[model samples]
Target chain A: MNAVSRALTDGWVITKRNLIKIKRVPEVLIFVLISPIMFVLLFAFVFGGAINPGDGVSYKEFLIGGIFAQTVVFGATFTGAGLAEDMQKGIIDRFRSLPMSPAAVLVGRTTSDVVYNVLSLIIMALTGLLVGWRIRDGALDALAGFGLLLLFAYAISWVMAWVGLLVPSVEVINNASFIVIMPLTFVSNAFVPIQSFDGVLRTIVEWNPVSALTQAARDLFGNLPPGETVSDAWSLQHPALYTLLWVVGILLVFVPLSVRQYRLASSK
Target chain B: MAVAGNDGDEGVDELTEMISATGLVKRYKNVEALRGLDLSVPEGKVLALLGPNGAGKTTAVRILATLIKPDEGTAVVAGRDVLNDAEGVRRSIGLSGQYAAVDEHLTGFENLEMVGRLYGLGGVASKARARELLERFDLSDAGDRPSKTYSGGMRRRLDLAGALVAAPPVLILDEPTTGLDPRSRQQMWEVIRELVGAGSTLLLTTQYLEEADKLADDIVVIDHGRQIARGTADELKSQTGGERIEVVLVDDGDRDAAVAVLGQVATGEVQSGDSERALTAAVTGGADSLSQVLAGFAAGGIAVLDIGLRRPTLDDVFLSLTGHATESDTDSDAGSAGGEGA
Candidate 1:
């Protein structure tokens, strides 16, 4: 095969290797699957009675989109952590020493991590349904919303992939991703409505990509209450388009950056 | 030592020099892992890089393996420039690093198959190659088990097998038997010997003097990121000098008399091992020195528990050159920084 074709083919092999880790190490999958369920239960029940999205909307319905946003965003950490852990192992040196494409490792890692998001999405959706979350929008639109979430998560995975290579340790990647993600998810419309925030925080939330993703999910799922309009900011006005821009922007910036970093990354 | 031909003979067509590097310098922060080191390995010959902890053996291997680039200088492996044609170099070399680089989660077969695939062997061929290697490494039964479950030696064999997946012309092994048991180490040596016997050029790094003595056609002694000496094993031994007469006394009291007698035949400094109740001195004139030492001891009435004339080992060579024993510091000074992390 040609170089590019070989890279993709090699990437597929690595992706399969990663997926096998998920299978062999079921605890990883269990923990990943449980967090989304726990998020659905915790936010829908613990914070459900206290937080209000608006009139005509149960907190459960409002929380589903936010939960999906948060879960998928959290899922991106797997990519970074996986890369960092692989970095710590001798396996990476083996990979580097091989004649395979350098980009294949990162491409495979980010690709396989999409499975984590998909699995958690399935579990979260089931849990969301049990908790009385409903999708009023048509099935195709809802499918589109899920697709956007996966796409957004995949892009975010590249960002984490870059961080994974930049950092020194796998444990550090976890804490590092937490530092960046915790604020991005919580400060947006993930667990609370944008209206709940005040002044600068509200403006920040209105433009936050997490908020755009959550807002788009809510719009597609028809979870937004009638008459309760989103923020007037252009980002919130076209949440899907804004979210897509962030996805594209993140991929464009991180893909090559991480690949370059991968080339430089040696097994310590 | 077979130094690189300095004639700049571009058309020499010497396939013998499968790997060569000049003035390789790698710095990790303030530590210079490799400083102006040069190396070359003839085709189908084994070159052992012998050194202690922080001696830059691994650093040199990493550069040649194309796992990391040096800060200054250049390397070519299998006729490909390490910097400009790293992929080409990689395609021609099989590298087994200090730690076994096999995946723990994957079965032995799976790990080798993955390596084969990455080396660009197609799916079916990768599997066949993996099975073939499994059989060759004596791991056919354990091939289905995850590498994490294998014994350390088994894991190491699996790792070496992974490196051989593509049967690259050049092979680099960095301390391949560092943690192995004696039997396993011997087994690994046998495997390595077979590879060399098959006419694959090999460059291996090791702290064990015996390992280098047994496996290497030529030895490079590196310390503190620099090449101190390079030669064949016999050449290195002879360069260190002639055999030494070691006299051990039954009691510590006789040590003084034994030391005095040994001094007569001693050609170099008469060194005493205080706790071992022994005095050793480098002696020239071989058998003549031995007879003189024995006759002198008899005249002095020094009780001799043991006495022998021993040839210089690589250990002696290491000590004579580095002013230290040939033992693993368990860490190399230059090993701490600058290599890329995966």
Candidate 2:
């Protein structure tokens, strides 16, 4: 086989190895499947009454899109943590000594984590619908929304893949991603309408990629209440296209970057 | 020691050079791991890199296996340049590192199969090879269980099996039995012996002198990233002395007299063992020296509990070369040597 095909074949093998880990270790899977359910329930009930999306939009419906955006973004950490753990375990050394492609480890890790994010997304969506979130748009539009979320999650996973290689430990990746992701997810239009914040914060939320993703999901799922319009910013108006741009931008910057790091990351 | 001469005289055939490295200098920040280290192994031969911890054995293996590039110098394995044609070198070598690299969450079967497939074996072939290796390693009963459930020895066997999955012509094992129990270490040695018997050119590193003596056809002794000595085990032993005479006194009070008696017939300084009553001394005339020592001890009324004339161990060879004991025997011989120096 050619180099590209060989790399893909090797990457698929690694991906399968990772997936088998998730299967054998039920504890890891339990946390992955439970976190989204807990998020949906906690935000829909605890913060549901306290927040307003304006114009009679149920907080549950408004929150679902935001939660979807946040969950997938958070899901990217799996890629980083997995890579960090593998680096520490000496498994990367074995892989490096092989005749496989250089980029195969990062590719396999990020791709397998997309499956994780997809599984969590399905769980979160089911929980979202049970708590009074509705899909008023056509099935094709909703599918597009989920597709965008997965694509965005996949891109972010590469960013985390790079972080995982840069950090010394898997625990550090957890804390480091938390410090960055919390502010990015919470400051956006994920939890409340962009109009809730005023001036600088509102502008920041409007331009945030998380905001674009949430806005896009709300638009595609038809979750926007009657007589309510998204923010006037170009990013919010073309939410789907804006989120697509972020996805493309992230992959372009991080794929090669993470692969470079993986090559230099030796077992300590 | 009569370090085996690097005359470049092994028939001058290019095909015999399975592994050749020159001036391999690797530095990690302020510490130099390899300083002008050079090594060569002919085809179908086992060359042991013998040294204590932090001796750059792992660094050399990593360089040869294409896992890392040296800061300076170049190596060729299986006729491919490690620095330039790394992939070609990788295709011809299998490396089992200092630690078992098997996935804890994957079954023994899964880990081997994964390695086989990554080596470009087809799915069916990978599965078949995985089974064959599992059976060979005596891990067939636990092949389906995750490696986390296996014992330390079982995991090591599986890791070695993973390295062999591709059936590469050259294998590098870095401290494969470092942490294993005696039984496990023996089992690992047996497996390695079988590989050598099958005529696979092998390079293995170890801290254990007995391991090198037992397995390697040629041994290179490294210290501080440089080779201090290289030769066949017998040649190395002879370089230090002909044989060792170890005597254990029946009473601790007789130790000093025994030391004096042993010192008289000894060719080199007599060294005390861990126990005050026991001592080992290098002797020149072999069996004649052993009889002389026995007669002296009998006349001295040392009343020895045990005595024997044994061939010199690698430890003695190391002491003769460096004036210090092996790391494992640091407490006793090193202390005696230090005291004598003082």
Candidate number with greatest lDDT: 1
Clash pairs, model 2 backbone = none
B275-309, model 2: which lDDT tens digit per residue? 88889998867788888888887898779888998
TM-score of chain B of 1: 0.80
Candidate 1 Cα misplacement greater than 4 A, ranges: A1-3, B1-15, B241-245, B251-277, B281-315, B324-335, B340-342
User: Tens digits of per-residue lDDT for model 2 on A1-268?
Assistant: 7867877888899999999988998799889989999999999999999988877679999999999999999999999999999988889989998888888888799888988988898999899889999899999999999999999999999999999988848899999999999999999989977777999999999999999999999999988877666678999989999999999999899999998888787775
lDDT of each: 0.87, 0.87
Backbone clashes (count) for model 1: 10
Give every collision pair in model 1.
Answer: A87-B342, A265-B341, A266-B340, A266-B341, A266-B342, A267-B342, B16-B43, B53-B332, B54-B332, B54-B333
Q: Which tens-of-lDDT digit does each residue in A40-74 have in candidate 1? A: 99888898999888999999999999999988998
Alpha-carbon deviation at A114 in model 1, angstroms: 0.4
* Candidate topping TM-score: 1
Name model 2 segments beyond 4 Å from true: B1-15, B248-302, B305-315, B325-342
Task: Estimate the Cα RMSD of every predicted model relative to the unseen true structure.
Answer: 4.3, 5.9
